[model samples]
Target chain A: MDDPLMLARVQFALTAGTHFLFVALTLGLATLVALTQTRATLSGSAVAERMTRFWGQLYVINYAVGIVTGLVMEFQFGLNWSGMSRVVGEVIGAPLAMETVVAFFVESTFLGLWIFGWDRLNRWVHLGLIWVVAATAYFSAYFILVANGFLQRPVGFTMVDGQARLTDLGALLTNPTALLAFGHVVFGGLLTAGFFMAAVSGYHLFRRTAEADLFRRSMRTGLVAVVVSVMPVAAFGGMQYAYIQPTKHPGAQESAAQVAQFEARFGPGDYTPPGLATAGEVLMEVAWSLMFFLAFAMLVKLPFGRWLERGRVFHVLMMAALPLPYVAMISGWVFREVGRQPWMVYGVLKTEDALSDVGAGAVAVSFTVFTVLFAALVVVNVWLLARFARRGPEAVRLGAPGAPEPERPALTPTF
Target chain B: MQTLALVVLAVLTAGYLVLAGADIGMGMLLPVLGRDGRERRLVIAAFAPFFLANEVWLVAVAGVVAGAFPGLEHALLSGLFPVFVALVAGWVVRDAGLWLRGRVDAAAWRAVCDGAIVAGSWALALSWGAVLGTVLVGGSRVEDGVNAGTVLGLPLALVFAAHGAGFARWRLASGLAERARRVPGRYWVSGAALAALPVAAGARLPWSQVVSSPEALAVTAVMCVLMVPLLAAAQALVWWTFRGRAESPGYL
Candidate 1:
């Protein structure tokens, strides 16, 4: 704890993990919200519109914190891990920059339009903005994964003058390490959204809210989303373990030669990952197994809508089960990231070497500040989400009619 | 490629200063601009829609620095670690306040959030000016202690507040606009402050020395070239859509 390197590492883990919690839900809910809005636009269904507004409100609330945390995540690299930038930045930086341009820039702009465009723009154009937002949200995640994948697998780069440089864009983008994880993450997001929707709807039904029909449709959508997405999440996750891990990980079956090469090149060191990596893997697998069974139960209940709605026990179970996907997803992330331990860029840049030249005190201060702030923000976020969720669709002001626009006075020529 | 990268970086930095600066400034002056809770909510609604988009320019600037000028990114960020820390903390608090202020319908909750907005905004504005001051005096290394430019940070923060007041003057309606108008040099102050950021940055950093490989630079530069125009169009659309004054409080 006194060591700056350890402190920095812990800080990164905590901050990034918290940020991912928001991102997972944001990515999933963005898609769900866009789809709901699309249904409303095409069919002109009032229920669908209300659903869009409701879900959209939740999405926006989550996204609000997500954006701020993301800003922290961006600055963190330069703040604590400058050596990573100085060494391999030529390789990974390209994708990160592309992410900023292709995803965040576009995503924010379109999202603003979508938020404020309510009754202002053409209905189709407004709908298109949301789809753009969702697509770009995935793109943002993809590019980030591309950069991270390079760190995990060290592909499409060649060492020049002791610094990594991009040798092939295609190789970087298509690295199975990145692509497979991207798939896993995307489906993981959907599953999370499915569970979140189901849980929120379940809470409403459990309470015997007046908006029973609205929640019933939402509940069905959530359950069906889970059924469709859960298997793919498992499949992609399985492929990553079966295929990518063996080739890239130090202790895995196929990477013995690579491990030997690393040992010879870097001299004596504990090149193997920590025990926490294995624990993360085990935890993730356990959570996923439980979620799979729960998903199966949901699928079974799908055929009998009225019975499912009336089963207060099931609703309570769903509300209880809400944390499963979160646990699975986070643990899975920990498994993947922590498993790459001791190497900031696997086999290329050692973790300690990647740290910025900061003192333990400074790093500790930052660590405490960020961790506390994130925790507070998360608490506030969940509280607000619960409050809004309980209030249901009627409380949504996302697309609600506003007071009349105030007349603009003539601009005083002040320049 | 390096020049193109620098141009992209310059553009993004200036854009953030001009756009996000206003909102941060407005946040800083929330109490002065709006007298009561309802009035403060109105004050926030004026800039809420544009805040997300405005802030992304700073994100883009960070991206450009990390991608194009990797060495500088490492040096500048780690060197001024404390400043960036404060800036980021303020950013988080201010944004949270803005997002959460209207969620709950309690006077105390809104007040707490409003206080967060004020304190966070001030922190952000001051830290940003300090960043410029530190960089201007070549305090790009931790060893470089306080200098003249560091002191200049105070006045620079004031400039941002003035810039924000200018924005409020433009975007607000009736008494709020009148309140903002009491600040001297509305549009002129805002324009000068916006123009000053890039100029100061340009004067301090040696752009040519810090660039990445041409291949890497070219890739990012190309993406920026392709997307910037689209970004501009969308940004214009947002400005156009919300061109009118704050008629009522928005979905804060």
Candidate 2:
């Protein structure tokens, strides 16, 4: 019973972290496809047309996986944190309401159309629908993020009868962390999408199927998107850092006043949690800055512009940059969450106060199960992705002009 | 204060169903809305493919009630067992019929399954609205000191269902959205009147809750006031997005 909060936190953390992989990639790639496909229509490139179908397929894969994993987090809030809900549910419920009513439905409607409208609907309108769908995906993430930011640094609510109740709708809407968090998160999405695009294009380049032009263009789109997205992301990361630096929640800032409290409890060898308390954050900030440059460099994968020659080095660099955003974002997230430390929902509840009744063994078992499952997904995703990568814009290339049409793989010849 | 909180909770709870419930109901109605027997069969074929996934919310809510408000849980779930029975019956029968319809692909079996889905959807919508209605209208004659209403015009029940049906139509297909747009005036009329009742109830409040905690009351009032215009805007947005080109798949 006492450990319920702990269990919930751990579970939510794991689920959120895992699901984010899908979301970041989805947001990044979905919009890119829309933009690129629109470019294709106007530019009249068969490669760009095939590119849309290519990236759109990956988006579908990511979105389907995300839809399942994301559901757990929503349910866990009610299942695990009912105590919090009864209190701030009025305001807390608003974004969630909008998410279901507007953001989610909008995304679903267009997503359904985009996926099934391959040959259906007018091309530009079809493009418009996909764009709307992509926008809604980001919009959905923003509202959920705002709700989370509120939890991290609650505002616009007043305490009545010893429980906090919402007192300002506008305040909740403009919660200081909202914009910053969204900026940081949406940029991360672009990085994920860019990496996915780069990897597939890299695969095609390696297999020597319809090379140079398509792969280089894909690298340009992937890299440029990441580079452009970095501006808002870096700005947001800074803002989020500032927001979490203070502690107004009832003596939450023990480090400021009582060196003794730290010394007393974590005394003998307790220099650890404090001395380098912000190390992860500092490193993450540096990492993000470096990745921003790497993304820009990746844009030179095009012929003779020379960020690097179109080969192994460029591919490796792009792949390396791909994981940088992943690391930087996750580290920054960790810094924020752990930095908040003692408080669960700031100013209202203490983290230690909320552990469930479960025991260490149970926690260990469930943790093991979740980790194994997540790892299996990663493995399966990689292998499956590799197979699809080999298939590369090749099938569509069979009909493209001036191209030595791709030969089907030997393994699955129509026997 | 408790009454106001309850009222807010009732509204939130009702909205939860009206919005997400359509997702569930339409999934159930998937097979039935098929073009011919074949397309309908195919539609039903993939319908509710991962249903347990979507139903997680209902379970989550129950867990919340049990964990957070143990007192409320017993009073509510136990006392409302009959209505609970009907709600569960609907969820289960619809689910089973969906599966059975697949296995027993005969037209009769398919008809039975589709009928069950529609009936279950009606029951699910009504039970949810009934619960909201009882909370608002204070239930009919309080047996065992628990409010249990028969669920007719009780406060906001009909309006909520109308809202649910509207959601159902919008979620299904453009054809359904068109059909919903053409739904009888009474449906929208009832919805408007029911939606208005809370504002009416709210206006007469001794202003006590407001006066006691002006700030909180102000926020609550703001939330309530916003609901009207916000809902109107959302409906308008939905219509605007899909208004033109009925023949095409308007993903506006």
Candidate 3:
């Protein structure tokens, strides 16, 4: 752990893992809230309006933390892995710079308008702001994956005077690895958000809270979202397995050829991923399969989720399942990142070569500081989320300009 | 084109420093100016919206640096790795604290968040100043390598603190405003006096060979000199435009 290389890897794993938790939620919830508000605008239903505010409130909570965590993620490139930055700064940094100049500004600016412009803007304009936020969020994710894709499988770049330079911008954006990875991540994000809403609403309805009608409706929406999203999520994961797996573990004959080639080019580095990463990949697949089955069961067996509406065991199950998708997502990320070890930019810059000329003590100290700070942040994030979630939607301040006053309670205590 | 890019980058950096300084000042002033939690909230709310917008300049500056001068950025960031990490951490913690403060109702939790804000703000101010000191003293010349603390560190921090206090003085009102006004008077004078160290240090370098274009350097220097009065005018205009007593709106 004291070794700078190991410490740096640990730091990246901790920061990226923690950062992904927030990102997954932000990506998924942003889409869901947009859907709720869009539906509310079209049908003008009171329940839909309440749904928007309630979930939107939670979305804001998650998004605020996500933005900060992301800032830290961006800095680590320069601070921890200066070698990677210097080698690929011309190529990878292009997308990141674009992410800031184009995607971030759009999402952040519109999000502000959508948040504070509640009473100021026209309703349609307000709705548009959210869609912009959602679009830009996904767009930002795309450019980021484009950069990451290059790392997974280097493309459209040439070594010029000891630096990787962009030779074809089009190929970089159109890289198959990045597109597949983007699909897997985006759909996975939706799945995470869907299950989260279902589980939270399930908890409320199970307790027979005063907002049963609202919770029941919310649970149904979540269930639908889960059912819809699981297909694309599975499809994309399958696509990745087919595309990325063989490259990692080539057939015995090809493996020999590849190893010899790699050794000739860049001597004495392990090209193979650790055995545990394969196990994690398997765990991710197994967990995703289970999620699919659960979604199907909820949709068909429950029939409008009426069965799940009242059963104590079912609510407990839903609540229990909340952390599973998160687990799967994290395992999948770990597998992906760790799979490409030894090379920070796969075949170009070795991880050892990419490190800054800093002392081991410096890396260790920074790692400790970041870990403690991140842990504290996660605690605050989870506490606020749980507290607000249990409080129900009435606790949501619903009186923004165009927002309607509270309707008479629709929830009847059926239990 | 390279010179032009460098000049643009310099302006962007200056923009971030001035804008973000005031924002950090708001957080730093929380413990100092706020008599209680309510007053603290008022101080935070006074600049929270603007803080988010001001922070964008940070992202933009970084983006421009990476895009425009990849080599320089590489050397600077790697050479100053420890400080960069600390600065990044400071930014993360500060953002979390400020945003999270308004979300909860618990007194203990609020206090924790406030502590995060104070610590983060101070770290950012100090680290940023230290970076300036490093650059001003010449990147490779400092004796302690990457870990060496620069002479400009304290002065830069003080100058930024003064900038923040000035913003708060103009933007906030009553007790908070009065306290904020005193911060610059306390720190800015000394900071200004100490600012000569970096200039004198930089004079030791072969100044003519610093960049390829002497005109660009001359223009930048003139711009740098012009910034002080320009910043003063800009702040004065903003204060007058939003002037009067500082009152926290119920919504913000």
The top-ranked prediction according to DockQ is 1
lDDT of 1 by residue, A1-415 (tens): 7889988988888888988988999999999998889999999999999999999999998898788788898888988998999899878899999899889998998898888678778999999999999999999999999999898888888899898888788999998888999999999999999999999999999999998988998999899889998899989988876545442355666667656777799987676777777788889899888888988899889998887678899899889989989999888888888888788988789999999887777788888988898889889898888989999998887877453322322323232
Candidate 2 deviant stretches above 4 angstroms: A1-3, A247-254, A258-283, A299-309, A354-383, A394-415, B1-252
TM-score of chain A of 1: 0.94
Query: Best to worst by TM-score, what's the order?
Result: 1, 3, 2
Native contacts retained, all candidates in order: 0.65, 0.02, 0.31
Instruction: Give the clash total for candidate 3.
Output: 0
In the range A338-385, model 3's lDDT, one tens digit per residue, is 777656777788788887667798888888988898788788789989
lDDT (CA) per prediction: 0.85, 0.54, 0.71
Q: Name the lDDT of candidate 2.
A: 0.54
Candidate 1, residues B18-61: lDDT per residue as tens digits? 88888998998899888777778778889898998898888888
* Residue pairs with backbone overlap in model 1: none
- Colliding residue pairs in candidate 3: none
Stretches of candidate 1 above 4 Å error?
A242-258, A401-415, B139-146
| Interface RMSD (Å), every candidate | 4.6, 12.1, 9.7
Expressed as tens digits, the lDDT of each residue in B1-252 for candidate 2 is 435444543454443453345445454344334434443433332323223323433433432232223334333433344554456555545554443443222567567767766676666656655654454445322222235444542333435445434544434344434444443323345555544544443343232221223344434334444443444353344434433322321111
Angstrom error of the Cα, residue A119, model 1: value is 3.3
- Residue A105 lDDT in candidate 3: 54
Residue A196's lDDT in candidate 2: 68
> Is model 3 an incorrect, acceptable, medium or high docking prediction?
incorrect
Tens-place lDDT per residue, model 3, B1-252, is: 444545555554655676677778667667876666666766775666456556765775666555544555556666777777778888888888887876766678778889988988988888887877776666445324443445567677777667677777766756567767667543344334334434443344332222312222332234334433443343343333334444643223
